[model samples]
Target chain A: MWDFIVERRSQLLINGFNHVYLVFLAVVFATIIAVAIAILVTRLPKLEPVANAVSAIGLTIPSFALIGLLIPVSKIGDGTAIIAVTFYAVLPILRNAVVGLQGVSPTLLESAKGMGMSEFTSLYKVRIPMAWPVILAGIRVSTQMSMGIAAIAAYVLGPGLGTFIFTGLTGYGGANAFNNVFVATVAIIVLALILDLLLIILGRLTISKGIRVA
Target chain B: MADVATAPNAQADARERTGRKRGPKLDAEQLIELFGIPLIVVVGFVAFAIWRNTATLDSVETNALPWNSIWIQLREHVVLTAVGAMITVVIAVPLGIALTRPGLKRAAPVVVGVANAGQAAPAIGLIVLLAIWFGFGFWTAIVALVLYAVLPVLRNTIVGLQAVDPTLVEAGRGIGMSNLMVLRRIELPLALPVIMSGVRTALVLLVGTAALATFINGGGLGGLLNTGITLFRFPVIVAAAVLIALLALLIEWLGQVLELVFRPKGI
Candidate 1:
């Protein structure tokens, strides 16, 4: 097993990096889009429900199915994988953003408006600051969920730690198949933990102290 | 006529005083509009995919759709996961209750942290390890699914039970109910909705992950997915994807119905 790890270390590293890249890119893209949609919907009463429902339905579709559906439309590989991950990631962030924004005290929002702040300014300065903790929690959940789903993207020939997993399964009778599975499992867990911790730290640093208190 | 006039005026005054008027909690038509269109589109897409896959269905002589094989696969998947979900709830709910005890609060986070690790562990990897140790097939899949599902169930159960009104429990005790009786009659009923939500979430997730069981040749929709991939058959792939998505939606809808049926009156 040790010999196997030493020999396959480079392949594992590349696969691991690919996995991280896909997840990170997806989360970052989804966060921006979700927050934007959340903000827009909050401004329009008629659009809010539409936006919310879209996000909810998006969440219900299985990630694998989403990827599979995309395969024909988009070329299979990292791009399709990233697109599917992004779709999956969007719902959590968007839902949380809406919830977090709505959660802010109406009085505070009115006060900001009374002070003649623009909608954008009030959002960035007050609502988002107040809602940061909840938003971060959503991001944390999305990050973890996406990471796992991204591994399954290997079936589509998408790169990542999933390679080791799929390869191990395919070569089940091979001598080092067990080692590949073990390494991949450990790598996925480690990656998830590290990402989770990083998000926690990011939350602590960015979220207002006042938001943390509640 | 005089009383009616006065009531209308009073209601108008109330509405003027309050920015929002009391009305139905959710607008049913609006909900239908919001959710209905997207659901239709999704369902339509699935139908189109199935129709497109008809030739592939013919190739197999079994409806090119692989119905029997799919059913057999789905049964094995569902049985393993159902048992796993049962185990998860059985173990997790009790552990969750125990963790909420005063003496255990200090250790709760650590225990939950370990469970979170279980959540983070890749399902394929977990299955692989279990297979290595247990020698493949159904038991290994169940063990992995249980580990994957336990944290949500445990956490939600604890949260729901804890959220129950303590005063109510005290009231039950005051009425001469024993500890077990109070828990069984009062706490469980109150916590049922929240606990069911967690179970619903876990169920959906389990169904999704169970597709990975194809890796072990354990059969299910995953086999459909795998065969589709190997044969370069787009129709087969689409068929599998549609079935899996429909299955997920069905489970979600069933859960919603169950929750409604079981929810306490006046809650």
Candidate 2:
């Protein structure tokens, strides 16, 4: 592993960066859409079940299969991979976002309205801020999920550390196969950890102490 | 982590959504909203299939698609899901129960953290790592799948067992029941629903993750998808995807049935 890392340091760095980039992009897309849908669902409670079910059913689509479906349309590489991964990442975040937003007390919103706040203002100032921790949790889940799915995106020639894994599989029984996979796997694990920790720090910095304590 | 906690809650949401036992007849708007999206997807797929009927799809006879090979692959896929889920339950339930015990209370965070890490890391990376270490085959895939699916079960078990009413356990003890008896007779029964929900999640996850087994040289439905991609056979890719999706839904349904069967009296 050490020799492999030393020899492929530059390649590993580039791939690792690519890997994080893919996850970051997917999570960003998922968070934005999920939170938006969550806000919409909160307005129309009857649609909650429909929204949640769609995401749940979406989870049933295998990553490999979804990537295959996208190949012809997205033409592989980053575009197809990112689209498929973003789809999968949407569920956990969307589910959590809906739960978080709905979890905000009705009375609290009513009081904001009582104080002459507009609907959008209450949503922006009261509901979302209060729901930050849970929404952040959703983003964290999306990050972890997309990290794994992004690796599988290698099948479509996606840019990521998965290139090493696929290459190693192709070269199995050779001298460097094990080393290649080992290094890539370790790198992915490390990336996951670092990303998770960063989210923790982000949560601390962004979430107010009142919500943090609660 | 909150994600782990959310697993059971998500399951509950699913159940609540679909398991409305004697609700009023569906209204027009509700009916359209519920079935509309799926109808669009089915229509879209059929349209695309018709539009893309190249000479390859036409000249390629029905037998040319290798149904037997696909079935064999699907069987292996099922094997992967079953073995992975069984191993996960055997290991996670006990470890989870142990963690909730008084003696192990302080160790819960560390243990849960390790379990969370297993899930946090890329599952494809886990499979490839196992393949590298153990060599590629059924066992390697099973091991990787187990690692990836274990977190929900463990976390759910801990949550379930901890959420059990303390007074029930106290009553069991008051009846001269030993710790083991109380746990078996009282705690386990109450926690069973939550634990079972976790198992269901794990099983569904295993089914999906098993698709990656093909990458490790372990044959499964994923092989069909990969082959389809290699050969530019859109039908084959769509077929494999449809089958996998069906299988996932089947397993999730089976899990719900199991939950219903195992559910204690009335809530």
Candidate 3:
């Protein structure tokens, strides 16, 4: 593995960058949509269950199937891949965001209002800030999920390290098959770990000191 | 004439009372979900079936459409999911229960952290990694699925066992029941719902991940997906996706029914 990485340093770096880029786009798309929907449903209350159920069903569809379904509409490329990954990312982040928003104490909201803060201001300043940790946790979940699913995006010709795995599998007994797949696998795992650690740091730095749990 | 006036007031009062009682409850929406999911599967499958019967794809080089090859892949998918779920339940449940015990308490965070890492990592990476190690087949797929699905079951099991009413366990012990006896008689029963939810989550996860098995020639509905994608056959790809979604929803429905069966009586 070390030898393979050394030999293919430039190629690996490009694939690694693609993997991160694909995941980054998908996560950002999912977080925006999920957070928006979560906030909307939280206010509506009655729609919360509907939103949850839909996301649950969305979550059940395999990454392979989703990419396949999107192929016709989006055509085989990064477009289809990003859309599928975004679909998968939406569920966890949406669920977590909803939970986080709902978890905010009612008394806290009341207190914000007592201070004469506008509803929107209180939501922005008090509610969302308090809900940030759980929402971040959701984004972290979405990031990890999208990283894996992004590999499947290779089916649609989406850029990622998954190209190596698929190519290795398709070329089974050929030379360098094992090395290609192995390196890609290692790269993906490393990426997942690094991303997770980044999120952990982001969580710590963003969350206020008084509210920080050990 | 007087009855008309009184009737209008009565109707208004009843409407106000019911509206107040309903408040923000989403009972109607929940009912729709209860009924709507199955309705979707039925409608979607019926539509797909019609398309399969009428829609001809001369560009297709693969086997007949989705249904013709579906049974083969469906069997593989179901068996793979079942075996994976069984392994997850067998391992995760016990470990989850054990972690709640006195001796293993300190190991909980470490075990959970490792499990979290497993879940957080890309699933395809894990599946392919295992395929390389085990030489690509059904068992390899099962192992991969098991590893991916275990976390939810394990996490839920721990949470479930820990959340069980402590008083019930203490009462069981006070009656001279052994620790194992208390766990079995009191704790497990109370934790059953949570454990079941975990199992359901794992099953749904396994069902989804099992699709990736086709990447390693493990053979499932994903074969259709991969072939359809490769050939750019629109009908085949969409039909396969619809079927896979239906299968997942049906399994989740089955899990819900199983939950009802396992649920303790009298609250």
Per-model TM-score versus the true fold: 0.85, 0.87, 0.88
Chain A (alone) TM-scores for all candidate structures: 0.94, 0.97, 0.96
Which pairs of residues collide in candidate 2?
none
Candidate 3's error at A208, in angstroms? Answer: 4.2
lDDT of 3 by residue, A1-214 (tens): 6787799899889989999998888888988998899899878987876776676667667778778778889988889988988887777778667767877899999999999999899888887888787777777767766777888788678999999887877777777778887888778877877887788888889986767777
- Model 3 misses residue B142 by how many Å? 1.4
Q: Of the candidates shown, which would achieve the greatest TM-score relative to the real structure?
A: 3
lDDT of 3 by residue, B100-152 (tens): 99999899979877776556556676777777778888888888888777777
Per-residue lDDT over B1-267 for candidate 1, one digit per residue giving the tens place of the 0 to 100 score: 011111100000111111111132434323553457447657766675567555445554334455567778768767765787799889888988788777897777788667656667766678777777677776777777777777667866776788899999999999999988988999889887767766766676677667777766555677776677677667777767777666666555554455556667757
lDDT of 2 by residue, A98-150 (tens): 87788899999999999999999999899899888877776766676677788
TM-score of the first chain in candidate 3 relative to the native first chain: 0.96
Residue A103 deviation, candidate 1, in Å? 2.8
Among these predictions, the greatest DockQ belongs to: 2
Cα error, residue B222 of model 3, in Å, equals 0.7
Candidate 1 vs 3: which has more lDDT? 3
lDDT of each: 0.70, 0.75, 0.75
lDDT tens digits, residue span B1-267, model 2: 333332121211222222122223444333443455455556655654554454355555344356577669879999899889999999999999899999998899898777666555666767877887888888889888888778778877898899998998999999999999998988999888888877877887888889889988877788878777777766767777766666666666566556656767644
How high is the DockQ of candidate 3? 0.23
Q: What is the DockQ of candidate 2?
A: 0.43
Tell me which residue pairs clash in candidate 1. B57-B63, B57-B64, B57-B65
Question: In candidate 2, residue A20 scores what lDDT?
Answer: 93
